[model samples]
Target chain A: MAGERVQPATLSRSEAALVASEGKAPRTERGRKTLRAILDAAAIEFGEKGFHEGSISGITRRAGVALGSFYTYFDSKDAVFRALVRDMSDQVRDHVAPAIRAAPDQIAAERAGLSEFIAFVRGHKEIYRIIDEAEFVDPESFRLHYATTADRIAARLKAGAARGEIRADISDVHAWAIMGMNVFLGLRYGVWQDDVSPEAVADSIAEMLARGIGTK
Target chain B: MAGERVQPATLSRSEAALVASEGKAPRTERGRKTLRAILDAAAIEFGEKGFHEGSISGITRRAGVALGSFYTYFDSKDAVFRALVRDMSDQVRDHVAPAIRAAPDQIAAERAGLSEFIAFVRGHKEIYRIIDEAEFVDPESFRLHYATTADRIAARLKAGAARGEIRADISDVHAWAIMGMNVFLGLRYGVWQDDVSPEAVADSIAEMLARGIGTK
Candidate 1:
């Protein structure tokens, strides 16, 4: 299976096996579209019922695809779940990229990215269930998700430092701190309830980041 | 079962039914000690084998008590697991409270709390697995664990603002953000690896909190 794998765009090496392909781009646009539908359905099935209760037939049912079509893209339920974890990670990155890129400074970029993330989570409430479940179903994928996310944040902070918009001593610790803050805030303000404004939450965080909480 | 329940010292109303016993505290000191042993052992058992594979027998064996004794405190495996989640939450709060109290200011208090949390996690590595697994095993317990933890953090932040040690605008958003930061930092530095100094990690976060990450 590993030998026959062809990496999809944005598919990390660790995620390659879960998204099984025959080492070539033989999948037509329709086939790719079908695979996308299957994943989307799996997210709902797993999200609502959880892994133990969720089934492959249910995924296909939700996708409006035949049972055989699931096997075309995934070897089993586990494979699809693994694939979904990576896809969600990529989806989050892709969804928030434009906002982060458009912001004028590092702090603004983080603020926009967080606002966009909360907005995304509100629409895709299943995201927390799916990603949190990865901890038990696939530990490596769970670790990589946060590791990659913190790395991305760290890289951005480094760039911000180079531009002199942030302190010179930024480290991986700061990256993890910011990432953790964003994640829990999203859970509390986005998925759990919707009354708090995302912009307001992000604005508060942005202010905190711009100036320490210590009284002047 | 609900009618006969008695709440433990720190058991939230949501977690009251899990640590089952008669509506009275009739057990002797030794019995109470035995119950404590069972919970600590259950932590190891569930932490290692997880909920499905972890057994009541394994918990008894680790606790060095007989199987019949297990039933004296808990109604069943599910009961013990739920009880353990609350215990862990209480344990974290108790462990960090002294450090937080001794700090000279809010920023130092936060740094101390994060450092203490990372240290606690290093020794009780199973904490992450248990609290996280509660999301699947017992959703309410999982929710209350985080909800209560965040509530405590928010209360502290609010108190800090009153003391003029922190900004007047601190809110639940900042509390969740800080809680999330400490949790992830504990996972990364405490459980995942031991090379990074917990004090150093907490120090950087303290610096960031004391004076926003923005350049002067």
Candidate 2:
């Protein structure tokens, strides 16, 4: 049974005990949970107060973990934020990737991917703030991540163009442009709580992007 | 005569000495000059360190004025940044207005206005950054300004749609999208130091906008 998918009796006994203990006690399983708690706490603190002002002790206290436990996972506040951004990026990509891959055409892919990304941002506003606040923390990491993503998307666009799926003249810069606009708009509309429908905004973006600003 | 353009000989004689000997300087003239100095200093500081980290003391020191003097022109750091953003918006409007007004049609108007705006942003990267960075500094000011400008452009696009100057299906949201995308592109390529040619970026944006993303 242990060799198969069956849970070990000892592991289940520990899990039940840990679940029962909750905030009154801390076990090894609970300690691992504390790591995620710290990240969540840090995300909120960093998003609200910004990077320079956010403190590790504040995050640790919020997470109900000891200050020393924070150091076990992250060396510094910046380290915590970097890991947070990487994690958020992965989460976002996971949320949108299938939608992006499922589109029948390049245009459809962008539209569908953008819509999914918007929903992902709405679902994870704190993580989105962490990603944005990280910009002032480390511009290089922010720029590098953005550029790499843009390049990936641009490569896809280029492939589409080669196959006559998209406009041949579409440059990598426009791909970056599209990416930046999406990022900026999401930050403004979703996280910052601007008074605009995310779907309406995305539809506007997709339509204009599909047709362009030109009169012809 | 008091009504004459030329100053009285006696007044002219003292004015030169007044500029040099009046340690406090002339109030109106000196204040105007100091305001300009403070704005220039604020721009440099905000550009270098971004908004939140930038301080009035730092701006005053950069302007070579007393710290108290900084408060006389601007009520707060927020005030200064708001003024800075307003100033940039004014400069952008001035730079692009004539080209847009003179164009024979929507396409020509967009081409000329957009290109001029891009060239201006390329030449004055700091101003562009200050305006863009306003999103992080004061989302309210940023959105108000963007919406105001966007609405004006949107109105024109709506008029065009009504007149059949553009496709009837195009919405005012698309106008905002166009405005947003051009700015996004220019900032990313020209200001953010993304490795791309401004001309190529402009051309691609123009082409994509002119044509739809549809597989024609």
Candidate 3:
């Protein structure tokens, strides 16, 4: 059942392009920074007021960029919202990539990924709101975000299996299971409350992954 | 880190009462069936058009009930949406509870729960849209739904541990992890596609629970 083809992460260039509105891709370094500002401000606007109530002006005000700059990069509130969803998805991948890369093995890679993810989420609590809102605001983006994330995870796990660092039987089910564990764990430890540290959360998950949770 | 208290599922009567709008609880068997009809209709309405576009009239029309019947059970569209969120949550619990109760062990119980859950999602695909929309439309219900579900899972795991059917170290983390896995797996195999059987998905998870996925 695990024979499905897994795509490489480098194909994200097309994804980055998708993050920009039609005819709105930035050409210069300054334009890129302004686009970044608009997306960040959007995160706050939609995150706080939701999609219907959130306006382009609110994003521009928070971004401190002119209305013209906003229009130059985004067609409208909906466009920017879609862009923000993709951007947030990218932000999480970028934030967690280094830790995942630095880990010594597959299990440790997952641990580092979760720890870094929780830390990132704590700093960007608005992330959950933005991403969750995408489910209603832009269904396609919502679907794409999870689909790509799960695909990336499956690809990585498959590589680890080939290297003999992970169970050879690892498949999409394991990938989705790991992703789900990281997501809920992040929601509980990162967004809702912070009584526990990220390292501690990662440690518990690492132990669980190292051995089954059965009593036998 | 896993010492948090997990309340029992029986506390859901208070939750059900909380789901109803003020002065809208059904008092008779007929009223209860009417209320059930309204909720089922609301699921289709919201599921098809979303919260904003879904209307009481659409729901009443689908339910083949009178307009007064909707008002008899719900104060407004918002009230019914909130109620619907809780209703879906309860529907899932009631749907999965029997299988869980009939299992021979905690791990089997979990397997049964996931299998039943996926099957339920397949039949009630609207559930994802309605429950996810609650995050924006009715934030409290959304939080309550997840918090209650996680608490129930934790409580079950704790009971299983006491009975020597599960690892004693199980706690909120494990509960959340399991819930997360079941949810994503459902989204993938249940809502997104049906190429894989529910039994296959549940079996994979049951094996993972029985033994860790680590190469060693």
lDDT of every predicted structure (CA atoms):
0.82, 0.64, 0.81
Give per-residue lDDT, candidate 1, residue A202: 96
Native contacts present in candidate 1, fraction: 0.80
Candidate 2 wrong stretches, greater than 4 Å: A1-35, A192-216, B1-33, B52-58, B61-71, B194-197, B213-216
Worst 10 residues of 2 chain B by lDDT: B1-10
Better of 1 and 3 by lDDT: 1
Per-residue lDDT of model 2, residues B42-63, tens digit only: 7788877789788988899988
Residue A90, candidate 2: C-alpha displacement in angstroms: 2.4
Model 1, position A17, has a per-residue lDDT of 37
Calculate each model's fnat, 2 decimals.
Answer: 0.80, 0.49, 0.63
RMSD of 1: 6.6
Cα lDDT tens digits for candidate 1, A50-80: 8889999999999899998888778788888
Candidates ranked by lDDT = 1, 3, 2
Better of 1 and 2 by lDDT: 1
lDDT of 3 by residue, A1-216 (tens): 001112212223355456678866777666776777677778878878888999999999998999998888778788899888888899789889999999988788888999999888887888888888888878899899999999999998888778777777778988888889888888888889898899988887887776642221
Candidate 3 segments whose C-alpha is farther than 4 A from its true place:
A1-18, A212-216, B1-19, B213-216
For all the models shown, what interface RMSD does each have?
2.4, 3.7, 2.4
Looking at candidate 1, what TM-score does chain B attain? Answer: 0.88
Which one wins on lDDT?
Answer: 1
